[model samples]
Target: MTQLTTDAARAVPTLSDEQWRGLLEVRATDPGAVARAYAARRRPDPLLSRKESLFLVAADHPARGALTASGDAMAMADRRSLLARMIAALENPEVDGILGSPDVVEELLLLGALEGKVVIGSMNRGGLDGATWTMDDRFTGYDADSISESGLEGGKMLLRIDDRDPSTAGTIEACAQAVTDLAERGLMAMVEPLPYHREDDGRLTLLKDSRSLARAITIASALGTTSSHTWLKMPACDDPDTVYASTTLPCVVLGGVPGPDPAADLHSWGRALVQPTVRGLVIGRALLYPPDGDVRSAVAAAAAVMRAAHPGAPAA
Candidate 1:
């Protein structure tokens, strides 16, 4: 049997070298052997490691009725295939972390993956697109305790405030409580805020003005118990300068739907990636399951943008 080294033991603090070695020694054991050994001896740490900064690909759209890829509708409708492709992409060396709905989290957990990986649970799915309840985002993912129990690092939620829509107030209050809960549990909460309005035709749309975006961010940043664990996931406004003024909290760009030219999309993403306060991207259908059906290539392209923006930067 291969013996575990001291450094290896330190790297995986949940298990001592001798215990890890013992587990490895039982090679002919049943399929549940490793799991039983892990359960018996390991206590996984449910904290985010500071070694790396991550480009968290968001594949949580299905829960929100966003199943399109580029121009193709129903792109993410297939759950099993999507999970397989996501696992493959995550296996890539350059890939770092994930941001997805609770269903996605359950899928990853059942696959016996996510160990030593940054797992961010999607906390909102009630605000389905085109629904009357779109403005009232609700927490539907892992709570602080569930996140800790599942060994997940953190969770994320969306906040789209449409002043014309009274539901926005409910979302605001819910978000405040959620943030307080996450902070008290020492879990990170990534919040994406949008100041939007429903047009006469009832199509929800974001205001193009920077002032609205800034105000929205400020309103979101002020929510929750502590601002320390909150990250603002904002969209890059028409004027890049406005992005810098939006919020003081650590921010990340939310990848919009992919365009006709993926290369151009990558370039635009690269530009957003270069923003000073922009930590990284929380990309969804754009990167995970592209219209092209090449998850590896799409993820690589996005990873390239991240690498170009912050060369040799560590994953978060």
Candidate 2:
């Protein structure tokens, strides 16, 4: 296996070679260490502060075969590199938490990096990117029971609605059940819903129109028996106010694939954060691997946006 290491002088404490070897030894022998770590993990005070805004770094895309960054197709293919970047991003105190798959979350937990952080488990990744069955986004990751057992703050699932794809129904049903299960445990159920259309070339195209996005919001909001504990992870669309107004459920804007201009992207997110219903940000690659390759700077800039949106919120 590849060994992981990071500069000790760096702000983030990357997994040293010794730590990596130790983790491997534990997994090789004491496989129960992960659960034990979770059981003994320390937690933060309140999940949400008075202002209710948050900033969760996302590191779950790689499990879905979506790893492109800065036009590099294989930028995230290296596990060590990905984890190192995540650690660096989390080093910024402004970063409230992370949204990651079970594997990533466990690794962070084992490293004690998740201490006092809001950890949200990713619940689905069966719909691999560029695959023929991409519309069938099954719940192949963290389930509600496991998330609850691990004491995570919430569970996240991807919901893609394709009018022409029958698999969409199965995903919807699964997500609804997950929502109910999580809610019953008094945990948050974050659903990311997108309207999709498959082209003749078998490529899935997301509908970015405000109406289509709003329709997706309505569908996701109505899932499960109740919406009291549900949160929407929505895109920062052109008309975020109009799209977000479709549902009363609190929302966190998703930082979609990064563009060439970081300022413009943050500007869009800032605009979306202005919406009363849009609580904060759940972003990934954009902030983790910015054009300038400074995770702290990127995260701080993003936190500034959140602060501006919730002027009365306590500082991070």
Candidate 3:
């Protein structure tokens, strides 16, 4: 399967004020258009590029009240700007798909930006960003039936495990069930598992040690009745080789909080992409709200890394 070429990859695209207003108007009066738009949208074929991997743009942060990016507390608060940035990334042919909540995905569908692009519906966004019950992540987004009915390629869920937080057990159980549900439908179930520990100041911190990550990977890998259609979304780490060795399930590197250097981010993802279990990238703020505020350039940079990284053999 040849990748989408430059000639096929479109130039920089636009989302004018008029089109923005039209979306608002439809939202105000005709809500059913959302469903119709999704049903009518054309789906992608041979979803992955020739590399047998994906480069998905993620926009599921806002749905969970995580509006901060690149030092701006309200960076992703503006829907119009967010949608425009997503379009900028999608126009580049190297971008294979997107992992977003229902609202963002529907907006892209209505805007006609998602045609022929893989779409992964975001699930389990009920845990508000900073709430005390953050560990009680609930499935407030697309379910398996809805994802399949919506013609999406798959559904994604976040799993945060904390020893002190008993709520983690519930979240784990829910994700396991979701994994089973998606597999039953013969659809992809993307599970992002991360270990967490609360600080004395009560800050929920992600545990980034290789051991912690490896443990999380094993747990997520074993979820559901079947692992046949499961994919793990892993955070960039210093020891991907050691961490990824914990599971045979296919994995995609996710861009966590953006750092000051985008090159560093790319280096990490590029390294992981070469790993047999690591398939591709599902990046969000790092590309959408890049330090330089150039979405296309950021996307192109990641795409360049994908081409240079030499992905491992096709995933089993």
lDDT of 3 by residue, 1-316 (tens): 1133454334323479898999999999999999999889889877667678889999999999999987878978988989998998998988998999999999988888999899999999999998888788999999999999999999999999999888899999999999999999989999999999888887888988899999999999999889999999999899988999999998999999988889999998898888888878999999988765677989999988877776353421
- Report lDDT (Cα) of residue 177, candidate 3: 98
Which parts of model 2 are misplaced by more than 4 Å? Answer: 1-14
Candidate 2 weakest lDDT stretch, 10 residues: 1-10
- Report clash pairs, candidate 3: none
How high is the CA lDDT of each candidate model? 0.70, 0.86, 0.89
Clashes of 2: 0
RMSD of 3: 5.7
**Model 3 alpha-carbon miss at residue 284, Å:** 0.3
For 146-236, candidate 1 gives per-residue lDDT tens digits of 7666556677888988988888899999888888888888878888888887888888877747788888888989998788889888876
Best by lDDT: 3
Provide the lDDT at 183 for model 3: 96
Q: Is candidate 1 or candidate 3 better by lDDT?
A: 3
Cα error of candidate 1 at position 101, Å: 2.0
Give the distance in Å from residue 18's predicted Cα in candidate 2 to where it truly belongs.
3.0
lDDT tens readout by residue for model 2, 1-316? 1112344225432457987887678878987899999998887668875457778999999999998886778877867667777887888887888999988898888777899888999999999988889889998899988988998999999999999999999999999999999999999999999998888877778898998999999999999998889999998889876898898889999998998899998999999999988888999989877766667788889988888888887666
Report the alpha-carbon TM-score of model 1 versus the true structure. Answer: 0.81
All candidates in order of lDDT, best leading: 3, 2, 1
